[model samples]
Target: MSSGQGGGQSGGQAGGQGGPGWQADGRRGAQYPGARRRPRYRALSPLREHLREAFWFAPLLTCVGAVLLAGLTDLLDREIFAEASAAQTADTLLSFSSAAKSVVSTVSSAMLTFIGVVFSISLVSLQMAASQFSPRVLRLYVRSRLIKATFATCLATFVYTLLVQLGYDDTSDPARAVSVPIVSTIVALAMVMLSLALFVLYVQATMRLLRVPHVIDRVTRESLQVLQDYRWLAPELGPTPGAVPEGPTLLHEGRGGVLRDVNIRWLIRVARRHDAVLYQVPRIGDFIAPGTPTVVVVGGSAPRPRRITTALNVGVDRTMHQDLSFGFRQLVDIAIRALSPAINDPTTAVQAVDRIHQLLAVLAPVHLGELRHRDKDGAVRLVQPVPGWEATVDLAFTEVRICGAGQPQVTRRLAAALDDLLRITPERRRAPLLLQRALLERAVAESVRDEDNRAFALTPDRQGIG
Candidate 1:
């Protein structure tokens, strides 16, 4: 995680460096004990990212659009109603004027109640879900386009109907609306129909969101999208590790946060401009305090510290953007939470494991490479470090395996996850899964007392039970 200022801010890549870099291994010689600042990235504001993921954003936009649409349709009605040829159609609409007013009033009032009651209940349910699953899932939940569309349509219909209702003529007759808005009334009715349809869809979506398996699937899909975005060199295809170039070092100079984003191309351009190699000391996702060495300028003039730090973005939480491992962290959190003593929900943990397995299987064949970024001439202009396969695998399986020790359901599902990965994953990438399998076997044997339960736990069952 680099600097996360906001808009379009990405998560850390699995093994790719997001611009800024640092060594966890103390290989950078002497360290600056007291730090100064963890500078922020230039592009992608935090507000923009929040708006992108925020549930209110779409509805707010739709409400504004509805206002403009109501006004536009009012003008359109005047144009159509003025023509002598339209007299017949206008008279026909006037006949049902009372019904139109009733319909508009009904929709405007009903939509308000529907939004209030449903959303109030939804917020409460979502809070409960955050506790049962991971709080992070809440962020993902609002990201559903259907959820946004549903809220947007409901609000828009309310606003449009209310405006249409106001234009109805009540002075001419108490029994009926004499000056009925022709096109506007039709538009309002159409909006009402759309809102009703969306309500049904929204209810179904909300119900699915409450289920653990669906949430896991959503998270997994986001992670896979991140994984699919990387065009970097794979591990086998990457260059050999070279010593950090000796040069002027730029230290972080802002408030510390998780390294969340970086413009790698920007880093390369800066390095290329100075004819120096830019070596990022802090990997994306590393929390850096002030005085922490970030970018090392090698073999050329030192680029301004602000210039180097600008390439990195920092944020309070990990995103699914460029960070491949962040997804794994989330899935693991859900698994660990489910396996906690108080919850002891083995089935939920199994669902989380299923996603973990899915992500690992996708990663197995990928050849993750070095964090080296090169210029047009093929010379490496920037170099950042990424976690290797072993570290990533450990992050995904170790914690869940440890927490799931005594639970037969969790252990068996984990075994199945490992075994499934072993079968599909390339031979070279199978080591970590094998190691995890052995550890799972050892843990289950040591924790579960009854021979029958132990035997059941040791067997690989994708379902965790018959």
Candidate 2:
């Protein structure tokens, strides 16, 4: 997102900035307001960069050579005729110039049309390249391609015009005319076509070459998603690799002031957005990592918690126990209900599971460093992150403590909301199973009734008993 153009244009690192920078505190500074510093490095000169980028230098040079050769041929033609009939040669040369003047003018006009065509093609190529690359890197690439294309097009047009004009100019003489052979003319035209074709191919190759990194980045991001979805089996929780610490962890500091008791309401909202259910451990305060299903979301009606995880594989560490003494089991059940139906059907199941998992990943492992909590003195404090990766629950509890008994009610409300969501998902698959069961029950009842009627018909005493 820097202002400067990049890629081979600067011969610097593809996206590298020329210096040092500051890491984000998640807020842009006042003076710098949303500005990020560029990385430091020296880049190649523009001319060299241009040469490297176009990758068309060799083809361009070939065209230039053709133009030069045509000029030389014209000179040789004039020399050969000058010795034989000076006066006649002069007259023929004059006529040839007159004839060529008009053609030259027409060719120039044609070239103008070609310029438009080239421009349109170049724009399309740039657009395609931008879309093909990462969104973050597109604009820079477009600018670079546009500049290179414009320059190359102009060079090609000039060379082509000169070469054609020289061909016509080379023939002169009345008695001993030095006219171009039809075969030679055809060959010259063919060479021009070949050169142009090569130039275009070069540009295409260059664009494809630049796409490699973008492809890799996309792959890496998707891989991260796969990791989250399967985190249930991973040794560590969250994007980073590490286990959440057990017992009392320091979430942050401050018994009072701007930061105080962790704002449970706001945290709950965040949890919901991620589709995670939050359960706070009772009396443990915000300072201790608490409970399983710390972040819960509805899933399929499995008898046991499956080895489910997230695409980002981030969230509460299943192995570490956060002592969430609060009766949050209800919230966990609700989340399970909400998530259950979506996962029952195979088609949309995985995506729904991943989405729910992402929600949990975002909220559950929220460490104490990410929270605000209060001390016994009524002083509020802000927790800071510790070294390395830790489960969000562990991190949230690391340096925080709970305040007041009213907290459980708020937690209950969250649980209720999740339960409501689950009810909406409705076990549609379960409905079919229920219908099947009902039909089976009806058939049984009918059979029993028929059997009793038959028996009564066969035996009058049994019938009376029936």
**TM-score of each model, paired residue for residue:** 0.80, 0.27
Candidate lDDT scores, in order, read 0.72, 0.33
Ten residues in sequence with the least summed lDDT for candidate 1: 22-31
Worst 10 residues of 2 by lDDT: 5-14
Cα lDDT tens digits for candidate 1, 168-266 = 676434233334577787888888788788878878888888888888888899887666544222222444455676878899877678887777768
Decoy 2 TM-score against native: 0.27
Report the lDDT tens digits of candidate 2 across residue range 376-435: 122221121222222322222211101101122222222232333334333421342233
What is the Cα-based TM-score of model 1? 0.80
Q: Name the top TM-score candidate.
A: 1
Whole-model alpha-carbon lDDT for candidate 2: 0.33
Best-matching candidate per lDDT: 1
